[model samples]
Target chain A: MLSVVILGTGNVAFHLAKVLSSNNSVELLQVYGRNKTKLQAFEPFCDTTDNLGKLAAAAIYLVAVSDGAITALTQQLAGLDGVVAHTSGAVSLEVIDHPRPGVFYPLQTFTRDKKIPFAEVPICLEARHPNDLRLLAQLAGKLSGAVHRIDSAQRRQLHLAAIWVNNFTNHLLYIGQQLCEEKGLSFSLLQPLIQETVDKIQQLSPKEAQTGPARRRDVQTIQTHLDILEAPLQKKIYQLLSESIKSTYEKEL
Target chain B: MLSVVILGTGNVAFHLAKVLSSNNSVELLQVYGRNKTKLQAFEPFCDTTDNLGKLAAAAIYLVAVSDGAITALTQQLAGLDGVVAHTSGAVSLEVIDHPRPGVFYPLQTFTRDKKIPFAEVPICLEARHPNDLRLLAQLAGKLSGAVHRIDSAQRRQLHLAAIWVNNFTNHLLYIGQQLCEEKGLSFSLLQPLIQETVDKIQQLSPKEAQTGPARRRDVQTIQTHLDILEAPLQKKIYQLLSESIKSTYEKEL
Candidate 1:
């Protein structure tokens, strides 16, 4: 069984602790957090501690804290014998000061309230040593069906690409919601279309799935939309994205 | 039974014909297309005609053609007794020169290859006359459960909003795919993250659902991403979107 200690009380830590503690293949030794109140949730599943120095002996130490907190936490974990890993996409594995610095980044967004299926989540594993890497991979396999041995450089690239797909894409939807509110239209009306847009990409490439005035270069429709948008920033964004799409297809044609 | 005739041979027309022909409450009279080759698909299902002059007698005529062709097609349907409507989000209902001009625009994007579930699609209906509107509504009800009586101006706004949510959103995903390809990473690695991004919005508002370096004002991560992006256009897009997001949250702070 994989003996794991979770460090932090945030969304990622909560999920990891919950999944690891319940798994037949895992023996969750402890969960550490600065706040005792946040540690209460992990108390029933594993040994909870507010002191980092009192962490239990385990095969793996997962630092599931924010990016800024990772470095400081890693310094405290330098004396630990276990594979010390940070569960971060943006941060490098080298941040961990332990001899066996590793990364166990689950490439999915985690929210406090939402209960995500851990099995479907893609866990990206990385470690300096081959034995630690294999152990990390085994732990990842127990948590998820999809496990990829991604290096620090590839992980950073994946994180950047994720921002485009998740962060910027969500912002675009927010813009659409604002437009709907302005027009006295229910945002729910666009829900099906929004869902279908994502669904199309499952089968077709994003370029092949793309449709609208921007891709087609329908000048009249484009002009009408620009005239309707009152916000200068929104109009500018519309113009820039449209120009980008137009140019992309123009080069191909 | 609502006797319906579908005009054109495109994605919209094909889907409309498939759904209408199968419904017991509707009699799909004829499918008219300028291209005889495209009309062959409708021959087994309904009466197919390449000549608009020999259009079948029906209670409602759905002109599911392109926005540019709607005006010209409607001019030919001026003599018809049926309530003539065009299935276009951008074009105005007044484009149809019939005594009863109507619109039955489906809010979802349609592709020739994808077989979308017609019952779930949100149909936006608009008509000048109450009788024609009722007739169109009944026809729409047989096809889809979700129907909104959206006016021309509101429809125009919805179309624009759709571009942001579907078209521009898909383009953002395309950019993400390009980044993955450049990094020698599988684009499929981002699939789960992309799905969760959309799924989160189903329960939460886009503003509440937003999570990223830009939203949190993590200048370090944003700068790292911008520096990594080699394309000038990609970098400009990243800066503009990040700036917009940063300013949005900054106002609240």
Candidate 2:
């Protein structure tokens, strides 16, 4: 069994600690965070440390601190005798500055309350040393069925694309919720549609699966939708996205 | 059993015809479309018709025609002896006129090859008369577990929102796929993140459920992501969406 230390108590750190603790191949070593209360949440399964010097005890230290805290945390761990890594998709490896550094960024969304099934989650791994990379890959494989070694450049692209698919798409749902309330329509009606939109992508290409006024190139329908959406910003977004979809289908708009 | 005349051969019409034809309560009277080849796909379970006048024999005429064709199809069905409606979420009910007009908006993403369980799909019903509304609602209920009396205003909003959540989001995935190809990574690696994103909405509100660089106000991560985006348009979208997400959490951005 391999031992690991997690440094941070945010959503990702909490979930990662919970997952790593439950696995038989992994031993929970210690948790490091500044907030004593937050640090106490993980004391049930492992020892606690608020100092960076204590993190040197573990073979693998996960720097699960915030992006701002990551620089200072890694700076403090610059002399640590272990494989230090950050759980960030966009942050570069140089941010670690630690002698033995890598990335163990999980490419799945994590909420404090939502328990994600690791069987379906994808873990993105990157490390300079072949041995350390193999260790991260093996450890990730234990937690999830799928694991990939993606470099900083690829992970950056993935993170941006996630913005489009997850964050942007979700904001759109929020807009729909607001629109539904105004029209006295229940937001529940659109839930199934949202789920299916995502499900269709599993089998069909997005370009081929797209269906709507813009996909149909129905100017009348587009005009009507714009008329209904009186908000200037909403109308702009609708137009930009509609044109984008049309261009994707090789249609002259 | 109620008789129905399905008037189109596209994805929506195809799926609707298939679901209705499979049920014991629906007596599929005829399947009509301008193209014989498209109508041929549904020939086994329906009596295919190309002429508009031939469609007057059924109790309900479902005009699953394109948004642009809805008006023309309704004009053709003016003298028909049955209730006429279209499956467009954004099209107004007035396209088919008052006394016999209706809207049968199946609020779900439909793919020609992927068979969706219509029982879980939401059906939005709207009609002129109380009797017609009830008839449509009952018919919709037979095929789906949930049915709602959604008007043109509300349905249009739902359609607009789907554009943001589905079309735009999928485009984002396409961008990610492009990014993966450039960096020698498989887009399939993103499937877990995509699935978890949709799953998250089940429990938390999209606003309350958002994660990533923007929510955390991690400008370094955002700047790194923006620098790595190969396409200029992609970067602009990334900037705008990140700004939007940031505005949601922090007003100072």
Which one wins on lDDT? 1
Error of 1 at A3 (Å): 2.0
CA deviation > 4 Å runs, candidate 2: A251-253, B251-253
All-Cα superposition RMSD per candidate: 1.9, 2.2
Candidate 2 lDDT over B68-176, as tens digits, reads 6777777777676667878988778987752599889988778799888899888888888888888788789889988888888778777776666666666666666
The number of the candidate with the highest TM-score is 1
Give each model's whole-structure lDDT.
0.90, 0.79
Clashes of each: 0, 0
Residue B184 error, candidate 1, Å:
2.6
Clashing pairs in 2: none
Tens-digit lDDT string for candidate 2 (A184-213): 777777788788877887888776677776
Per-candidate interface DockQ score? 0.80, 0.63
Q: Model 1, which residues run further than 4 Å from truth? A: A251-253, B251-253
User: lDDT by residue for model 1 over A19-110, one digit each (tens)?
Assistant: 88889889999999999999999988989999988988889999998888888888888777899999989989887878998999998877
Task: State the lDDT of candidate 1 residue by residue for B1-253, as single tens digits.
Answer: 8999999998889988988898999999999999999999888779999998899989999998878888888898878898999999997888888888999999988887787888888899999999999999999898889989999999999999999999999999999999899989999988888898889988888888887889888888999999899988888889989988887788776
